[model samples]
Target: IRILPHVHDTGAFFVALLEKVSPLPGEKIYKEKDAEEREAGESGSETQRVRQPPKKKQRTGFKEEPYFYFEKDEPIWPGISQFYDMNPEVDPTHFLSRTNDGKKRNLYFTNKLVKDVVTLNQDHIKIINTGVKVLVRSDNKGADCDFRLAQEGSQVLLPLFKKRKISITRDDMVTMLLNDDMCEPPEIEKMDTKTQEQCENLESGSLAFTHKREDGVEITLVGWKGAKSVRGYVAKHDRIHYLRLLNADTSKYEKNKYQEQRDLLQKNGSIDDNNENSNEILAENGTTKNDDLENGNITEVKENEIKNNENVDNEDNGNGNGDRNGNDHEMEINKQTG
Candidate 1:
């Protein structure tokens, strides 16, 4: 179905729904005869028989992942799993996937997300992409630690660490966000005694931070923490939220963190006192929205008052629109004089 908005003065839209018709078992194919032209049809070949091909066996249930034992990574799981209480229902081994690659592979917990999405690929339906990559090969070597966690994967494990012993202060959060890739976390000394000890024993990499925000919100930031500094990775969009959050409370973490946020906005030539009165709400539902600057479709929210304890109420940023980047940040930093 099609609708053209310009001509009809209605919104332009197109939509289609298809019905699935699989041939029944032992059913034969028959062509429809021309009823109008041929009235009293001749006997023999008037009804042509078109042979139907045999149906291939369809995959019934979900294809289960491999049966490799996660207990094998027992030594590895403790470092991460210790922070959060274990789920009694889920067996770690169930997360294992089939990997024929010679490199050692680690099992990541999809939290049953794969099985949840299996229906999308069933019944010959095409799946461009479905499951989130949850596990990383723990046995391999990263620059610092044996296991390198995927950015999303760390969040999957964040809950386990959120209330755990590795809470970092807000200042440390900014350090992790601003650090170069592969840099160490600055406040390793501020790490909780138990978690810090774990890091001391651990070699360079294997850096993960569970920032327990005031009022108990948890954000899991991952990076490599070496002897000196812990290097963490925050997606482009996340960086903006972090910056806005830090800036909203200048004195909460440190005066410098807020200053940095203000400076970043100014660096990008985004400042206007008049824009203060017309502030945009950045947060939505709970998270903040970051915009890509290159498309020039950036939406700005001016934090009129720096609330000492109030949260940064910015909308959630998305990259879905034609906005762009390779800048490694999700939202473009708009320099606001406020």
Candidate 2:
């Protein structure tokens, strides 16, 4: 056994190597008693005693919806096969619907392996759903096709569609993606000459728009062509994703709250810095004025003290002069008396 240390936010635990050499002394007796009880219960030996009735078996789990694979001669296959110019090699049996009835809403596509698995184990297991949605029922009377192509399966079925598909340029793809209004899709005339020419004869329905780069990277998007306008059928998130792939600007869709907060802080910080700088400047000017006043007051006091000292010295000198005069007169009088 080994006990592991709790470090780096991990829990303390232990591991042990266990081995079972023998069973307990009462294990065999217990198993025999359990078997006897099961046998007695199965044999209905206690029918004399009153017991509750067994509950009826209840069905559980998800409801099973069987897949209905389409045949090559199915009535709905003709319209789709003719509209999309489906390749003859592509079998219609690969497509399926959830409904067995004639009213099929969506058609899904599956590869060989998935198809085999679903077909073989359909009766034994419950399959919730399988395959990619390739087509959906669009009951528009104006549309030539009954079903429209779905974006979910566009990549898988792109090569199988020869008609209702056009090659567009990077700019045209960007223009279609940027048009947010479904009612006012970008007009076909506004696109480049090649795209306009390619879409001239196309009917108002689903379309496959493909763009290839110089580096052999290709992108395929499902689109819808209206009477006079066309637009991409991609979702908002997918629109951003494809725009990123095409190296187009997607700033309109991307929002970063963190970056916005940082920008606001920087602007406020600049204002705060300006305020601090002005305060510092005012403080510096006030200090210089205070120093000048203090120096001026000290100089005035020193000048006043010097004037008082000079006056005192002049007074003393005059007193001494007077004393000398008096002494000389007294000496002359004494000499005359002698």
Candidate 3:
């Protein structure tokens, strides 16, 4: 029955009453209001009390809950160490949750999913969504090259991986982060020649590269290896941030030093050897000597090449005497040919 404010003509309220069914103690019978009794309105006096039905029972939803194991004493640390230097202090069970058995290949995690996962284990609790994905899988089925880290995970793991042994240089770091594409693994020596000898003995697994600039240390992760290339991945925003770290102040000093040394070794004979390079550099800067004469020389060269090509084509496009084009074009040949 709808309830109305008796005093004024204000907004009316809707009252929907759902009938509750309670099963008998012994028998498997639920006691519900008879349809015939509900149709016929209450004939009893107002003094006689009316029994209001209880609220409908909510769904438990426990069946749909996934099987989650959060025990800390698992042997997961050793397996993950093959890919990343696993920190035992930070509980991996809290964040890095696995799906099934056998290395739990389909691993998933996020920042604030801890509380959500806990609440999901409860009755009638639900989870809408989680945070960033961290998929670390392999291309094949078996254990050849299985420990591959994804690009998205690299952003968070780069700093942690920096402390580890596997790393690359500033120049190599820049090239690997050109895009999300897989590139040739950065040379170990170029990263830091005198850093350490242990850098050379790198394995085909998850690796991180760092470039320490004036601003900050830029890092990117590389994964997998096949066909003389590895799966190098980095975020675009991270790359742009690191690119600003390039030290541009000492450029003039380095260039002048290089030019001075090169000039000292130059001689009259050596000048001709490097003249083509000098001409290219000059041409790029819009410096052309004897421009008209150079243009005429290029035109003559082009005409001579074209005439030679036409004469060669005569055999290709000709039958015996008359040409295929049937045009009265004379063949250009050298007079000294005879």
* Candidate with best lDDT: 2
Task: Kindly provide the TM-score of model 3 when superposed on the true structure, using C-alpha atoms.
Answer: 0.43
- By TM-score, the best candidate is 2
> Residue 102's C-alpha lDDT in candidate 3?
54
Candidate 3: tens digits of C-alpha lDDT, residues 190-290: 44454234344444444455445555654455433322233344444444555546532233223464574444333223444565765543322222233
Candidate with more favorable, higher TM-score: 1 or 3: 3
Quote each prediction's TM-score. Answer: 0.43, 0.60, 0.43
Alpha carbon deviation, residue 244, candidate 1 (Å): 1.6
Could you arrange the candidates by TM-score from highest to lowest?
2, 3, 1
What is the C-alpha lDDT profile of model 2 across 10-127, one tens digit per residue?
6767787889898987553222235676866665443244345689975554476689898767888988989999998999999999887778888999988999999997777789
- For 1-338, candidate 1 gives per-residue lDDT tens digits of 77565685666787889786887798676877677546766554456777777899866544544333345455555654542344555456535444433444555464455644543444454444433445454332333233455566666654443322255667767766654222122456764565566566555544567666777777666654545445554555566566676664323334365675765455334345433421221111011122123111234334454332133332224333323454423334443322
TM-score of model 1 vs. true structure: 0.43
Candidate with more favorable, higher lDDT: 2 or 3: 2
* Model 1 segments more than 4 A misplaced: 1-89, 93-108, 111-128, 138-146, 161-165, 181-198, 201-204, 248-338
Superposition error at 233 for model 3 (Å): 1.8
- Candidate 1: count of backbone clashes, pairs at least 3 residues apart or interchain: 29
